[model samples]
Target: MRTNALSTLSFWNTPRIGVARMQSDMAQANQEIVTGRYADVGLALGSRTGLAVGLRQKSAELAALRDSNNAASLRLGTSQAVLKQIQDGADATLTALTGVPEDKRAGVLKDMAANRLGTLTALLNTSAGGQYVFGGTRTAAAPMSTYATSPASPAKTAVDAAFRAAFGLSQDSAGVSAITEGDMAAFLDGPAFQGLFAEASWGTTWSAAGTAPLTNQISLSETVETSASANAPALRKLAMAYVMASELGSANLSAAAQGVLTTRVAGLLGEASKGLITLQADLGRSQAAIAAANTRLESQASLLDAQIMDMEGVDRAEAKTRVDRLSTQVQISYALTAQLRQLSLVNYL
Candidate 1:
């Protein structure tokens, strides 16, 4: 007859092993319950893990796009506000020019235009989030230069030189009184003088902005220009109007010359106001487009969240149940192991 012998050491090790495995299962279940996700996404998703990873990556990209779009929207809104201020200033100046008596026009309009030009320069050089908002693609630096002479402003110097070359006399010279309305008109409208606000000359002196505005990716499929350049025709015209009204020695000009200068300034201001309104409309459209893109992004994000949850998220109730059962099994295994350890030869004696 053959007899089977049970090893006490093997008996002691068996329940200890079972308890260790049950504790590990309990820890896994507890984690799943706490996090509401599978403890190991790859292990749970297996062959479809790549799909989950791709979806999560795409979702992250969408989130990034939405964040950037929000920033672009803010910048656009700020730009629009500044544009409104500039338009208002232009309108107000035109009103003052037309309404003020002829004798008072030069002094009042000159002082007002100078102050407004400074304000406009400050506005164009406005910064948001450490970036100059009106700098087109050149956001790191101020887009507009101050209209001043002390620091030898490039724009001021250029205008002064152009005036001297055209009339063979400085702006403040008494010879300005001799300039016929025809000469003033020719200089203001001709290539020689109008060229100062042309794209090349404006870029060379008045503006540091690029011709192309800054663009933003509002969504996976959509991109929009989110900035304006100081060198845009509307802004250039406004600056030119201010410079002519304030810096051309308008106060000393004969009444006939003043009339020509004021008429040109009024025309430029009107054109600038119209162009600025058009710009605002374009930005308004961009804002609408960005808002629509964000809506689509939110919907896509929600769907992706649902799909990711299906792949990686766990059932909290089921995980809690598993934790409870594992806890009981581990407790029983521990008790049995303790009882086995207490089984001594002295107890059998």
Candidate 2:
């Protein structure tokens, strides 16, 4: 066995090691205090770390679902408001159609219909967050075609062709007076004319929207439609009713013929109003579902947070106590090191 004598180097080295350890403890405790979590999560929880990771992942998923629900609510809420405006317009048009004298009905209703149709087109093209809300799944562009004839819209051209094929005369022709009420009714009821408002024709000429509406997943089990299509029967019928009053020669027809047109227009508009109401109701239900799903998501997130906290959370009071004690110990170690450095044989003498 070899015996080694203690020297100044040995005395200095022992305190240095103790101070280093104290400093390391202080750093870890301070970290735990500031973060309210273990400085090393995997080391603290060991085998339970995987459970904490899974809970955090589930919490993140819940947050994402809430965000999606918010977006869907925006689109659905805006769509419902717009549909109400359209329904109000149709109802008002019906009233105006019946109240006006036959002599003034065609001109007044035509101007009203034209204005209403322009407004309707713009509303149907509404967008939210750069996405077209009424375009169903086709969110990239405006769903409705402009009714302007300067560019010769496909819808306007189709309507003109239908009118010509029915009466052998243009809609604005002076010979429209010879079109009797029965003849006008026959033309309206005819397949060739009614086909203009059919789903296929509307898709080809009037709308750029997809047949399928957009949907969102509010939760793991709940997915609901978040959009309304411009090509819905209500919208098509509403557009056709407006086109007839605005485009066809209602202003040039006989009183009885105008009456026939007014009655038919009123009926179509009424149906459209009902359909619009139904659409609003459907969206209202979806809104309710999203709201309910959000409540559930919040509850689930809260439970996950609690479980994760139990596994990984630091005790703030205990960490603070440890940090204060380590700080005192570190200060004492520094003082002792300074004292040791100042020691000399002359001071002892």
Question: What is the C-alpha lDDT profile of model 2 across 128-199, one tens digit per residue?
Answer: 888899999999989999986596899899988988888999988989999998999999889988998899
lDDT of 1 by residue, 49-68 (tens): 99999999999999999999
lDDT of each: 0.89, 0.89
**lDDT accuracy of residue 7 in candidate 1:** 76
Each prediction's TM-score against the native? Answer: 0.90, 0.89
Best by TM-score: 1
lDDT of model 2, residue 111: 85
Whole-model lDDT, candidate 2?
0.89
The count of residue-pair clashes in candidate 1 stands at 0
For model 2, the run of ten residues with the poorest summed lDDT: 6-15
